[model samples]
Target: MNIRLNLVATTSLVALLSVSAASAQTMEELIEGAKAEGMLTTIALPHDWCGYGDIIASFKAKYPFLTVNELNPDAGSADELEAIRANKDNKGPQAPDVIDIGLSFGPQSKAEGLVQPYKVSVWDEIPDAVKDADGYYYGAYYGVMSFAVNTDLVDNVPTEWEDLLKPEYAGQVALAGDPRASNQAILGVLSAGMARGAAAGTASGEAGLQFFKELNAAGNFVPVIAKAGTLAQGTTPIMVMWDYNALAARDTLAGNPPVEVTVPTKGTLAGVYVQAISAYAPHPNAAKLWMEHIFSDEGQNGYVKGYCHTARFNTMVAQGKVPQDLLDALPPAEPYEKAYFPTVEEQDANKNAVVSGWDSVVGANVQ
Candidate 1:
């Protein structure tokens, strides 16, 4: 009787082991399981941008079981970084699964070890120049830094960067705050530097400080608080901004004269809002799945609808997702083909220098 009982126990254990092995999930299966877990992914993004709202809505429609808690974080990227640093160990509601921050801040965040490395399967489609080698961050969407000329304010719009220095447009051109205070503004300075024929590493390198000194001297600078819609409404006639923001401005001022957005002939600086998973994410598996979803065809096409460029190389075009006519409206990717994205080390070293130079040279004169 004892031998029969031991054999039955052994048989039961074997059966249980077989069941467990059969139930093990592949990566795809694991993703499905995570979706069913009904977990929430908290995102920190700029509340003012309309594109963000559209992206959030699309994500919810696709994943009804997953909850996305969007936090405004009213503060800019710098403020978000400070908040994250403060809550490193005890991440309160502010602890985010993902963050969408300005291009300039991407490197700093990565170097500080604030980001986690998770390479999405679609990573191969992204250009090497736009993504970090270690997969700490990847640019999800980008905008070319272009000039938004309020045709109503100036009779002859300045088409090129050098044209801004002409005596006629003096005191009319406005930048987005200081370069140090606003990354968009810095890109503007960078664009101007390129137009001025400054080589890389010169004081004028990465948007010439020397050229800005001349602009400041010429009194061509205008000052206005940086917000999404106000600049297009003629708060400041000519301002520098991202292509999406410029297009939105054009749409806003449709009835009242048009705002012309020009990509400088010398090529404009492009800024990307990169995406990264937080190191301390509570739901690591969910975060990885979310990154995969964002890079998928459906997600890439979503950006096109919002008038923003998709990050996926050819997903949108191959799938016939975006209208061909819309392609014409986008600035050719080739002109910006030589665009610069500072490395983590270079950015960290120069961030303070860029900020300090702007403060001493241009900031004091803007107001």
Candidate 2:
């Protein structure tokens, strides 16, 4: 009977491993596999931006054994794609296990075969429009465009698009990027496109460029990308930037005067940044674990703490997966209810149009 029991135990162990090998169906299995893999690396995630700093901290606190390597905290989205291409076969820190990039980069990445498909446990909670049905990439979080106003320099905080063009705001309105090349700047224009035109917005219409043209003509449009220092120095006191950026400056610039973050009343465009596992990931198990952690309730909450609206927020609320304080921290949800998220195709097209048409519309070089 002892011999029989020993044989049965051996067979059971083999079966459990087989299931685990096929996929990490349970947290216990996922963790076990991740520990074996031992390391994970990421590209272009600035910890301070979008609550990544705290998210990384919490992730480390949870998985002490799993070494998390953050590479190039400031690399752009294009640079991230290049890294995946360069390290397709490497196993060292040079090989990225995961990537978070702009929405426009998704279709291009999938088509180029730079990433593979893997669905997190919270996959169903994510919106279908923002994620691949095959599970390659999913929306991580979205930030609505907002005004980061310097109250010291300006008496009236422009609440709407038309307010930005008023004489009082001349030389005060600044864009975050060059519309010809900057996605951030493009999103600012796109957000303004909505407020300048009808319900659908003018990404494809003539109004977007015209609005900027008028701002430029009025000397209200500052060509340079504005940063916190610029705001503090009063160079670009009123910057058109992401809501998260504006809100984050509150804590980051706590020593300076308060930075007010406001969502425009005439509707605004939202930009979604998606996360994906590298197809050439050297640490495959660790990569999946990282994805699981990011989509997990704890991970989503980390983003909330940073002032970004997580892609799974509504679902988290329904399931009671988020903390109350994090929920309370979010700016009012109604103004953003008017916020529109374009399809990947729509985003790509709009981006192309914005970049190509920027020269004709504004024509001013970023000084």
Q: Which candidate is the best by lDDT?
A: 2
User: CA lDDT of each candidate?
Assistant: 0.62, 0.76
Residue 92's lDDT within candidate 2 is: 82
- Off by more than 4 A, model 1: 1-50, 65-67, 73-76, 102-104, 205-207, 282-286, 315-321, 328-352, 365-367
Per-residue lDDT of 239 in model 1: 77
Please provide TM-scores, in order, for all candidate models, with all chains considered together: 0.77, 0.83
Best by TM-score: 2
Error of 1 at 346 (Å): 6.4
lDDT of 2 by residue, 1-367 (tens): 0010111101245434533453445777768878888888988777667899988888888888988899987565667888999988778889898999877778878878788777788777777767876766888888888899888887888888889989998888888666764556766777677776643333542466778889999999888768777888888989987888788876788847677878887747778888988878888777887888888888988888898888777777778878888778888877566677766776677667677787887786864
- Weakest 10 consecutive residues of candidate 1 by summed lDDT: 1-10
Candidate RMSDs in Å, in order, are 12.6, 9.9
RMSD of 1: 12.6
What is the lDDT, from 0 to 100, of the residue 72 in candidate 1? 49
Cα lDDT tens digits for candidate 1, 25-92: 34676467667655545554443342555666777776677777665434456655665676678545
